[model samples]
Target: MSESKSAKSGGTAGSRAGGTEGAATSARIGVLKTYKLFVGGKFPRSESGRVYEVTDSKGNWLANPPLASRKDARDAVVAARKAVGGWSGATAYNRGQILYRIAEMLEGRREQFIGEVAAGEGLSRAKAAGRVDAAVDRWVWYAGWADKIAQVAGGANPVAGPFFNLSSPEPTGVVAVLAPRRCSFLGLVSVLAPVIVTGNTAVLVPSEERPLPALSLSEVLATSDLPGGVVNVLSGRASELGTPLAAHQDVNAIDLAGAGPELARDLEIAAADNLKRVVRPAPDREPDWRGDPGTARMLPFLETKTVWHPVGS
Candidate 1:
């Protein structure tokens, strides 16, 4: 009987050991993800080699995004300028296809964006999901505009002379965009979609505090058939990057939607050095991004060009 009891006790201890080992295997730690900047169709670390901690709305540590420097901003501008010719020359229908593909990719990664938006904006999961949907929809909306904008904005003009006078809108070349501080994702799509749909390349400065979503967006763009440097994202202080971009001699326009009152004034002054087209923010308050985005946002970055040809030539 004593021998039997000893065997049973040994079996019980072995069973407990197996259970402990299984628990340990199940409780393994997860690997963390390191985010990088998207530049010229590639992911690159900042030239400054500096990173700042990005926290959630509740002050919880999220991740460290690169602290973009003046050099980084200039590099982005170079990338944007390099891409201008090919991107602007592409047919509008092709541009629309690429933009729609971006929407499809964004929809595929909807859950991930929902989480990031929730954490960054301090919204509930449902609300964050809603914002993500809106952002995706915004891309589709802009894609549709790609082929139609020309029809709506351009036409034949009657002239007294025996010549055909045609007026059409053309891209204003490289544009420097400041992504809004609030509505990080939706506002970003709102401003950025308009610029690129018309065949203009952009050097975008995402929201300083909530840049994770924008960084993730770069991943989508890289795979969405967009040419290298068509959209370069630099994550850092807007004021730091916007100042250089506004004054950039090569940049064709400046969108100050994300700048504060004081910074906006300064950027406008700098933009004057090159007579860059400026999209000034509202004087009273931030415009509601959820409202219908009319053609107002797209008009500033477009220049009307008139072509005259002899009728009988």
Candidate 2:
């Protein structure tokens, strides 16, 4: 009789444990279902109705994911152009605060992003975390510049003739940038912050091989109180969108990175049509990622506008 009671009690305990295990698994799956492309404060599928395969570092194909197309790229540009003014018009102090917010958010989510970088960049977890930390630090650095870039980069230039003249910086509206093929998110943020801090809009093309962080960044931007249209991101073949963006009459500047001579020449010609300012590539060599951010990152977004006031007697 005692053996029979013992068997019955054990079966009841096993059933309860199975029920709890099933509930925990369901919750995990629920979290995975929440991801999608971010656009205009909403999560959306690629309007092109196309999806491509995403893979993990282990070479395992992640499920169906939207392939952002040319049309989608253009759409992102439209959004960025729309947001340019208000974000740029904001007092530099407020802009700096918003940038600081992003850094805080990144730090809080460090572990999640670190793992993703490991899977996406094929970096070890420690290395990926190191890069992530650097990226977050980069944001904090730019946050300080949001209000002060003008004073640092601009000054009174003694001219052949001038009457109490001063030259100050201004934002160039609607910038298009191609991020470096390596150091994905760090490169993307480096290109972006200077432009936005100065009030220009941007459309960024992330590194082709690893794009997950760029998408994730879009999500962060969506929540960061940045106006829509200030920063647009597209992930696809850089060649496909490079010419259109660099040459587009509406865009004011093109920051080129990670391309060969053929593309470089093509963009140079396209930029000439409008006399748009083009930030040339660093000489055929690797970037010193560990170097200081000010000269390396901030200088590219600057323009030397000559204040031409006639010298009066």
Candidate 3:
């Protein structure tokens, strides 16, 4: 009878311990991450204090990204303009190192980016992993081009006169890039890397529907030795932000990769007001982000300057 009583007591204690463990597990809560805009090398809430719902391709609630206003767009321009001189004046080799560093940092965070990309674009984990890998490789490719673009794009020109004429490429100051709406991560990297790799600071608008991956990239940029304001990412309606950016006199050029036909038409007209260089989108179809990027995107943001010197001098 005593043994029977002791066994009952032991069973009761075990049951009580199991219940406590379950309660503790139930009490644990997850910490949610807050998304914000990346401007001037800092993460800031939108000046307008507005946010819009972001959903995955399946329309599942993801998170609310900042709804950048005209004021926010202007602020990003200010930040990009401020960074232009310093970033543009850096040696090509130094820029290459920084670009390479971004790739290194991105590789370290590969799994995180893969998850974000998968959710944002509604892709399988394997496909998203491929996109993330491509994005990292793109950065490394541009890094190699940083110090060598000048060699391929510029050189001494043969002249009949007794003077030497040399032409070289220079950054076009601040550029506004509309990141592609599809292939969110890879496409964003494709448009963004070329703009900044060549010394131009950028005000970028990520794919509106799939902006989480892009916002996450801002964190990578912050830690990758890239100067703040060198690449300002505004997560919001492209139409709202692109309007002010297109009309801003200080923005030296605009890439319409992410803009729709109607919006692209309007932005092109607005960009004409200040004679800004424009990279117009293809009228029919978007270029395959997975294909060879070539130098076409980089050329639009570069200006050629010719210098003449007497042969004797």
Candidate 4:
């Protein structure tokens, strides 16, 4: 009788454990997210009506980011051009305020970025958070430069002809930037903040394989008091969009930080059609975006206009 009772008790315990395990396994699955492109301060589906699956470093499906086409790149350039006069001509103080606002928005959304970075790079949560923090800090660094870069890059030139010669740096107009393939967020911000902080408008091509953080960042920018069309971001194949942007007469410059040697060489050749200033990465490698980005990044996108006035009337 005692054996019979013990067997019943054991069976009951096993059944309870199984039920608990089944309940734990039944937790709801999360809804996946869809990432779109950001252009002219708005989120829009790619005109091509196509999206490419973005996967984690482990090859797990993450999200589908829009695959921007040449038409998208052209539209981005048009938007950038429309924003140039106002954005580039805005007072330095105003530009600084807008850049600081981007940092502010980023701070509020840090946790989301931390998660995205961790998944994209297969990094530990702590390391990913550190990267996110660094990206925000980079924006802060560039914010301070907005009002100061002109002073450091331009000044008076001594002239012998009884005239005052003044050299001043001005924005180089619309620049198309190819974001680095690795470290999506940090590299993107590093390339982008420097380009726009100096009063230039930009059309940025985010890393094709990992574009979630870049898409999210567009949300922050849209609400961060940055003027519409000042910064347009596209997610797609670099090779497809890059060629048209380089050849386009409207684009004033090209940043080849993410480009390989072959593509960079081809784009550089095409950019020559309009005599566009080209910023190429080191041979056979992407730029070390994590390293110090000195004034070199800013200098190429600026034009030095020297003005002279007769001293004696």
Model 1 steric clash pairs: none
The parts of candidate 1 lying over 4 Å away from their true place are 1-26
lDDT of 1 by residue, 1-313 (tens): 4324322322111112233433454553333456778889999999999999887788867777889899998998899999999999999999999999999999997867776787788887788888889889988999999998887898899999999999999999999999898788998999999999999999999999989889989999999999999999999998999999999999999999899999999999999998999999778667878888978888888999999999996
What candidate 2 gets wrong by more than 4 Å, as runs, is: 1-42, 63-65, 159-162, 304-313
Cα lDDT tens digits, model 2, 58-170, are 66443344566766666766776677768767998999998899888888767656655666667776777788898899888988888888888788776565465677777
lDDT by residue for model 4 (22-141), tens? 346554332345677889988899999998887778886667789999999989999999999999999999999999999999999887787777777777778887888999999999
Clashes of each: 0, 2, 1, 0
Q: What is the C-alpha RMSD of each candidate to the true structure, in Å?
A: 10.0, 8.6, 9.4, 9.4
> Which model is ahead, 2 or 4, in terms of lDDT?
4
| TM-scores of the candidates in the order shown | 0.91, 0.82, 0.91, 0.90
Which residues of candidate 4, in runs, are more than 4 Å off? 1-31
Tens-digit lDDT string for candidate 3 (119-177): 77877778888999999999899999999999988999999999999999999999999
**Ten-residue region with minimum lDDT total, candidate 3:** 6-15
The Cα error of candidate 1 at residue 38, in Å, is 1.1
